[model samples]
Target: MECFRIDESGYTGFDLLNRDQRFQGATAIAIDDEEAARLIREYFPRLQAGELKYRALSRRPGNHPRLLALLAELLRAHKSVTYVCDKRFLLILMFCDYAVEPYYYERGCNFYEDGQNYGMASLLATAGPTLLGKSEFEAMLAAFQRATKEKTPAALKDLVRAAQKTKWRELPEAIGPLAQYAAPECLSAIATEGVTTDAALVVLQSLITRMEVMSDGPYRVEHDQSKNLATYHDLLCRFIGHEEEIELRQSEIASFKFPLKLTEVVQVDSKASPAVQLADVMIGAALEAANVMTGLRADGLDPEKLMPLYAEDQFIHLIPSVDFAEQKQFRRGTQAAEVIDYFAANFGPKK
Candidate 1:
């Protein structure tokens, strides 16, 4: 049976506001074991025995060129898919979905389907710091994150109180309605079934969907062993060959009906699997490229320069939207617009 190897980078496990690791990325490669070993032998000859870790290798001198070369060759020779998620932006998305969207939904509106969720999330992610004070904004997000994990009435109430205490009167006109509509009941209903904001699951879902489309028949997956392996296994089982519906407050919120071509999902040791090691390198390069694009890491090689090596559809990025160039002329709106423009110009799908 055909099998793909998978690995991930920058996992902070629901801590979307982690200061050091802001992006999470995963990669899947369809190369066979023999081919992966041959490529590793050719490009990374210095590594004699252990698994190839991009983080450690990247810190060493003269390894940048080798890493870039390996990535370029892998993209050129094999079928691969990459997914990257901006964790902070993901937190904004979760807040809009859980805290804000349900209020509108009860009134016969769907923010997600209508793209308003992205719009509001982009606004908050970009301009919230200036309007609400960076500390306040982060504290609100931290509260939401905690409430999501705890899933208790007290935690949900705290999230609502955080929103209620925001100084929305001094903010822009656009944010006024959002503040008014921020309902505690919305978060309560969402917390009923437990909220999950893990970016790894998001990345895995995207990568698996893309891989299914790329493959001719059912394929299995071999992933690098990690603490979240059981969770990953459960997620894969939930959707493989079946339609799954996600419900919020007993209402059908989202549905995944795609016929999965996945047969099995198993975790393997990277030290024993060249394919998984290659996946590690691919994901590391992708994450480093994103960090460089966002100015988080300045000294690494920019893999965006190697965009031409892969197919246009090979990479899927679940980052914040940069399409808010025409926001209102208020101070926060203008600041949001500038941030959006910068991201739109710097990082996104290269046409």
Candidate 2:
């Protein structure tokens, strides 16, 4: 379950075939023990992002007997020969999802897509800092110096234009039969390393789209009823000490079973505004009734007796019986009814 962020750099490869082999389009590449370690570092960060788990060889470099033996064999076979072991190719190795595929060594050819490919540059661009690569202040300074040398005293706007124009030189040149692959938006260089060309393009596209629809200020909705539910929940917490025990029902998950000690009940409205009052009134009446049910004799209104007012199903209990312990345990449920009734009687519509 351990995670690691690895940095891939400082790896070299040697070829097993001679220059004659390369001329005939034949080449062999092999990695040494040191190079394997470097590949692990490079792929580590990407592996963590994909939620992978693996024991790192570098952590127990001495204990990696199999890896060491493999490297030793390859070294012996290619003694005095060289292979171009491209660690850049190893960058994709970090994306192995062990949960889905456990055999990392024998996994066949890793496929890559030109359009859907994501890389480090794109990751950074979407989640990067305010500034990238060279500092803005430094860019300004260089532009100023170049303008001065040109003897034109360029304006601030013109200097900015020059800087942007300079970035166009980083694009890769088109080559071979696909010479037309030289795209206008192709990324030759980016502020981040180890990112693919297409990934950089995605980041650039996202930036452009975001800039197009930037917002300027805050906005509010005048007729939001969602706020009323929150206030009702708050009132329940105040009356009943079991703030955590009260469960607020949502439209989709409205039906639920209550324990034998609990019941579904309601408070009645006896005041001015019944229809539109957000909080339930019947529950309040039941709470007031519970106080009397407990033999406390406060106006002789038994909240437990009032339980029938809201109970819909026999199994879904809303009120507790009149025993001293039950009364103490169900006091919150009782008070819940009382609070709703008290508030509604003073403010709800006339019965």
Candidate 3:
């Protein structure tokens, strides 16, 4: 069976609102053991006796070309995929999915049926920070994070309080309701059900989905050893033909979708696995490129310079994309223009 080596970058657990590491990424590469060693020996010859770490190599001047060359060689030789997450955007999605949608669902509304959820999330992520003020926006996310982490009614109430305090009147119509009716019980249910907002798991799921599509049959995964390995192992088990129901509310039961095909998942040391080391390099470069593109980090590396090496097909991002219809909804002088302007400046096709 085919084996895919995986490694992650910017792992801040479920803390999606982390300011320092604003993005998380994972890369999976499918290559033979011999070929992986060969590429490492050719391009990264100095690291032949040591582990290949992207951060260390990237810190030195004149190594950028070598890293890019190595990545290009790997992409040309192997089937590789990278999944990136805008962590703050992910928190916004969770807010819409867990808090907002469940409240509306209990009122006989399908928040996700017509892609309204995505639209709302896009608006909130882009404009919420500016409208609510950075402190308030961050407080709202911190409250939700505490609610999910603490899994207590009090913590849930704190989230509700934060929501109630949001300046929703100054924001879009789509986001106003969240402040008024975000259900504490629904938020509590997410925590009680042990649902995680981990970007790593999100990346793993997407990678597995793509890998399944690429594979003709069952495949194995070798991941860099991480503290969350046990959690990853359990999640992988559930993915293999397991079904569960999530209690979104007292009256609402949502069936969880498990779209994964797998045989095994093993966590190995990076020093021992050349493929995992390569995956580490791939994910680090990809995450840095994204951070530079989004203005999350100023690492002196020009994103446009790396655009040619950063193939669109090789990377998958969890960031939301608002359509033109949605963009036009925001009038020229309205508060919604903040959303439009943010997207126009930060997102879309990078030229």
Candidate 1 C-alpha lDDT tens digits along 26-54: 88889888899999889888785588788
Ranked by TM-score, the better of candidates 1 and 2 is 1
Off by over 4 Å in 1: 170-184, 241-256, 324-351
Best by lDDT: 1
Structural similarity to truth (TM-score) of each candidate: 0.83, 0.15, 0.82
lDDT of each: 0.70, 0.24, 0.68
Flag clash pairs in model 3: none
TM-score of 3: 0.82
Where's the lowest-lDDT run of ten residues in candidate 3?
246-255
How do all the candidates rank in terms of TM-score, highest first? 1, 3, 2
Best by TM-score: 1
Give residue 351's error in model 1 in angstroms. 45
Off by over 4 Å in 3: 172-178, 182-185, 228-230, 241-260, 324-351
In model 2, which regions exceed 4 Å deviation? Answer: 1-272, 276-280, 302-311, 314-351
